[model samples]
Target: MYGRGGWARRIERRLAWSDSFVIVVVMVGAHAARFGWDPLAAVAGPSATPYWQVSVSVAVLWALQLGWARSREPRVLGHGPKEFQRVLIASWRTFAIVAIVGFLTQWQISRGYLLFALPLGAVVLVVYRAAWRKLIHAQRDRGDLLAQVLVAGPARTSEQMIRRLQRNRRAGYNVIGACVPGGSRARKTPLLEGVRVAGSLEDTAEVAMSLGAEYVLLSGSDAMSLREARQLGWELEGTGIGLIVAPALVDVAGPRVSMTPVEGLPLIHVEAPQFTGSQRVAKEIFDRASALAFLFVGGIPMLVIAAAIRLSSPGPALFRQVRVGRDHQLFTMYKFRSMYVDAEERLALLAGQSDGNGVLFKMHDDPRVTRIGRVLRRFSLDELPQLLNVLKGDMSMVGPRPPLPREVEQWDERVSRRQLVKPGVTGLWQVSGRSDLSWDEAVRLDLYYTENWSLASDAVIVLRTLGAIFFGRGAY
Candidate 1:
């Protein structure tokens, strides 16, 4: 019943305006920072063009490039790293193009100006985008600005799609109805409770248009052939609606997927995720280096935590426990002791009263936790000692959380795949929900991280970990 992205367009317009303002300010600020806001001060060279003029060009070009890059696409607007990636890509390419043009023309562009503007602008733009995303997510949580969707598939798959979409409201897909392959009995009947089948597969386009759905998903489209699918697309030509085919693959990251046209037919290919070679080497190097950096910064705070632990509890400040690492290797994990000296010995007696995720042991207000231990674990200060574990080559800065040997013993074959990479002090599981997530959900997140490992995603997880630590939710 709503126009396509009317609310989205409102947000996009605000973003475009903000993008211009940010670019302009950064460009002028860079020039001012470099040349001291002097009216007559040109660039670095004598008889060079005024940096003020150059700033204008860069600002306009950068904003234009962002638009051309489709960084404001509604689908990528409120969620995922794609929106940020596009913004960064567009900004980088804009400067790259500017550099090339200046070089070809033998123009004296101020390196200092660019050095300041490029990084600053990129960071600011992304930060602003993140702010916008937060706002969008807040609205989505309130059931605002969602794209109305109608799933067209078999009854089972349509229900599946509806449920998944409903689960992730942050992605902004609101499935209002569906078009399943039925002899009209399933029609006017509840597909999955409140979500009913609007019509049959053949009526997908008309139904989507009638319902004013923004998206029509052809999930499990076994009833439709290639020609019929195309015809459906043709039918929705001027309706301002989009058609998407829900590929059979799930939990696969974008980098591993590609569509190859074989004789006019699109064939999707999924590459197996590699955990070895250059990527692995790079990850290891980054882990150790960052761990060292963190330890340097956190040294004093860690000492204070350790001292507090010693004062609060009779146990030694630093606690070393055995944990499983890469390839099922046993490693001594480090932590600031947050529990009493006899906590482990008292575990069996308190086992049955465990308020854990079934597989793990966690108590919100555990008697074993000392006074200072609550503060330490709440902000993850207890885990800071694991930086040494990382540097000792026993762990990574980002990976599946190191599991207890006993916990590992109970895992299934799929869960055991976590051993393919080194464990981390913090991970997708911890960031998602520390002690509150179900065992199955936690394993699913770990496996997802294992299969879709990337430096970018790892950085994102680490950032999210900071927020999780600050909030202290589900972190007993």
Candidate 2:
């Protein structure tokens, strides 16, 4: 076990060191290409040091850059672009320092070399970091270099966390088991499925040491006081085990979280959700312009699709279904007829064989779907008519996914929160897994958007949706 742990640690260090080294190598290469081998030879002619000395100086400068950035620290890895940002800052800082020193000392350094090297360093570092991250994720999926965590929480929260982690295995958390605070319950739940009970809160340390847990996660509502938590931390100190506290706040975005220290107490503040006034105006303008442009530029494609539907199937080219929108208002959602006109009539007959969630009916290979319809649905061409809905002020450029009236009727109370703003043609759900998502997961994404809508976020979702549609992920 110790050998395996040491190997994981070594791999972590190598990834960081190699990334910094590769960045420096590219920077030096770009500098050499921009300015010839003897850039300073004009001023220091015949008295210049050997070429190897110049290479050694560049290597020293690169090492200094890595030290200044602290890129080797493990705290900033695996998430966020902060690590990349720091590397860029360090590279630029090195260039500026060198340039200033050279100018002050009247040393003849090549401006051409410095200019090319800085950008080259940035591009190379970004590319290398992305490639390495892909490799790490691939290995993680195979259960390599993952953290074995023991959850210390209520049975319900622990069960939910385990299920979520299991569903997204690439996240790299292997939940070994749970340590319920009040001991196990008689009524069996999925909580203890394939997991041994390690003991209650008082025996946390014993369980941790025995199970060889690398990390311990405390659920927010678990029965542990601040003092008790501190004691637990002290006990686990110097054990190479990590402690994570799960906050009670759910579906909140990073931008919405603010930590303030007042009188030596840290308090977390959550901002209210608002997508109105200037934001609403901006969304409206965006929708109107995009809708108009698509309608005009895409007129030919729309007409051709209409003709194909008419030829392949004997029905109107367009299909309209009632959908619930903002403020619980109803609007006619438009799409190309992917099924026969009597699709609704046929739905009842196929109800028992429905492959969709209990609330939504879907079939992977429904006989009602025509050849042209399947093609259109694959690339999401059928969703084009909804652009008109956006132009009509019935929808925004981006919001929660639009829901059918029947689906809306089955939604939980919190689901109605999505109706606080107009529905959209694409949303977080569409960009995420779309139809592949469980009903609960879909609702969670929609609620997250509703409770934390931002103009920047909307723009990002739209861009991601474009890529998702082209790739046809989670689309039948």
Against the reference, the lDDT scores of all candidates come to: 0.85, 0.74
Regions more than 4 Å wrong, model 2:
1-140, 182-190, 262-265, 285-307
Error of 1 at 56 (Å): 1.5
**Model 1, residue 372: what's the lDDT?**
87
Query: Positional deviation of 303 in candidate 1, in angstroms?
Result: 1.6
lDDT per residue as tens, model 2, 1-476: 22136645676568657865785576557546855555443433244453335445655676567656865444444333455666677777777776675666566655665566666766576567656655766777787756788788776787777776677655556778778766544222345567656677767766877888888887654577777887888888988788887777767875678999897556789988875778778778888998899899998999999999999989999999998989999999888888888888888889888777677787889887888888998888998989889988888768888888888877778878889989988888887778788888888888888888776677667756776888798787
Question: In candidate 1, what are the lDDT values of residues 378-415, reduced to their tens digit?
Answer: 88888998999999999999999899999988988989
Clashes of 2: 0
lDDT of 2: 0.74
TM agreement with the true structure for every prediction: 0.93, 0.73
- Clashes per prediction? 0, 0
